[model samples]
Target: MPKEDQNNLLFTLQHDFKTKLFLSYIDIKFKAVLINSSTSWYKLASYTIEEKNSVLSKIHLHLDDFVTIYEEDHEKSYAIIKGIF
Candidate 1:
């Protein structure tokens, strides 16, 4: 897709869940996958995030696509990614 279209999608995703308290951040990861027939498909990208509270936030895009937010606690130290959509 065009850069502008991708940016607009990202912006829309951000706005959809800005009010939620649990979402810490959203990161986009793009990948290209090739099938046996040599056709390629662009994954919609992976959205990952860190949570600040116990509540699980629900994210929805204009297309009605959604991802559930959750927290992962480890003993090492402290870090967070607030949103992933």
Candidate 2:
């Protein structure tokens, strides 16, 4: 959809995820967003928010758990927010 809609959807996921679990970090880039795993270090899911927002939105909305988000972009436009989760 539109960029604004995508942004709103992302915010919704972020809010819901934070309410359910303990998020480690969330980063938003250009191509995708990366969510840090709560248990393992190597466990992470890189999601393309713009493309998969619809599907992911539904999942995240219902499952309010800690899920780190990292946006995909050149030079890594995303960063981890420490002590926020």
- Which candidate number has the best TM-score? 2
Residue pairs with clashing backbones, model 1: 24-82, 25-82, 25-83, 26-83, 50-81
Query: Candidate 1 residues 1-85, lDDT tens each?
Result: 9999997996675555453322332222324422232223242334445569755555333323443445465334433443323
Q: How far is candidate 1 from the true structure (C-alpha RMSD, Å)?
A: 14.0
Total backbone collisions for each predicted model: 5, 15
Query: For candidate 2, what is the lDDT?
Result: 0.47
TM-score of each: 0.25, 0.28
| Stretches of model 2 off by over 4 angstroms after superposition | 22-85
Native-to-model Cα distance after best TM-score fit, residue 80 in candidate 1, in Å: 16
**True-vs-predicted CA distance for residue 55, candidate 2, Å:** 40
